[model samples]
Target: MMPKKAENCISCAVKLTGTGFTRFPCPDCGEVIGRCAKCRGQSNPYKCPKCGFIGP
Candidate 1:
């Protein structure tokens, strides 16, 4: 069977799968960033440390 994995970060659109996984949207789940990659590194998603330059 195929294992299920996070596909997109609720904050940033960074692929929660392969290559993009290197970086994560929310360091952990249950959190939201309300941003995207192009806006930062990914898109329609968040990077990390929402308390940083990231947005609300």
Candidate 2:
């Protein structure tokens, strides 16, 4: 098996990767394990970068 790659990474835009500390999101907090261009980072006092919706 080989690693995956993006052909148009520069052209392609990702709103959020949703990859946090763990693969699964917090059941109570709804935290995700990913990167948000808007948020810069994930977790604690988290909010939706796309909509500014704060996490519970």
Candidate 3:
């Protein structure tokens, strides 16, 4: 089963709030990942907590 969406940004560990935050499944593990708008805009890399899959 797919993992639930994270409440904090995976890249920066910031609480996910307001608009522009995003949640999507990890390509390797189907685990949900969360990203804040700042991190996404900066192209910061994030690692999946479940499978260690990293992405830009």
Q: What are the models' TM-scores?
A: 0.21, 0.26, 0.88
Which stretches of candidate 1 lie above 4 Å from their native place?
A: 1-5, 18-56
Candidate 2 colliding pairs, count? 6
* 1 or 3, greater by TM-score: 3
lDDT of 1 at 8: 50
Stretches of candidate 3 exceeding 4 Å from the true structure: 1-3
lDDT of each: 0.40, 0.34, 0.90
Single out the weakest 10-residue window by summed lDDT for candidate 1. 30-39
- Candidate 3: what lDDT? 0.90
Which candidate's lDDT is highest? 3
- Native-referenced Cα lDDT, model 1: 0.40
Q: Candidate 3 clashing pairs?
A: none
Q: Compare the candidates by TM-score and give the number of the best one.
A: 3
State candidate 3's TM-score.
0.88
Candidate 2 ranges beyond 4 A from true positions? 1-20, 23-43
RMSD of 3: 2.8
